[model samples]
Target: MTARPLGVEIACDGPTGHYDCPHNAAIRAQFTSRTARQVRADGRRDGWRARPGGLDICPDCVKETTR
Candidate 1:
């Protein structure tokens, strides 16, 4: 996540009602010991990378944290 003027702009939730996205089988519904980090092109394409100013967060992680 990126540092926002107010605070860190972490992902809040997914578009679907479920935190888990059926469309993306690569991602899991829950995270335990994961720490949100910046994504580089060299890293796994499965995850998202933060934009120059925006943060990247998986749909599942976003939903779980928001709740």
Candidate 2:
């Protein structure tokens, strides 16, 4: 079976915002090595949550938020 890409949970500051966010992209790029443990640690440090599943931010969100 194919393994799913690890996803990081970008915590909502106030209200439930779009999943696609620059912060999420930055974090994912920063942790492309797939060191989930380290990613999680870093996420916690950065006030985000890195975990499993398809929680990665979507491209639309990235475009909208980044712009």
Question: How badly does each model clash, as a count of residue pairs?
Answer: 0, 0
Q: What would the per-residue lDDT of candidate 1 be over residues 1-67, giving only the tens digit for each residue?
A: 8963321223422333345333442323232313333222312354533333343445454454468
- For model 2, residues 3-63, the per-residue Cα lDDT tens digits are 9976553432211243335444444325464565556555545545422443533443434
Among all windows of ten consecutive residues in candidate 1, which has the lowest summed lDDT?
35-44
With candidate 2 superimposed using the best TM-score fit, by how many Å does residue 12's alpha carbon deviate from the native?
10
lDDT per prediction? Answer: 0.37, 0.44
Question: How many backbone collisions does model 1 have?
Answer: 0
Candidate 1: clashing pairs of residues = none
Off by over 4 Å in 2: 1-19, 22-24, 28-34, 50-67
Which lDDT value does model 1 have at 8? 22
Candidate 1: segments with Cα more than 4 A from true spot = 1-32, 38-44, 57-67
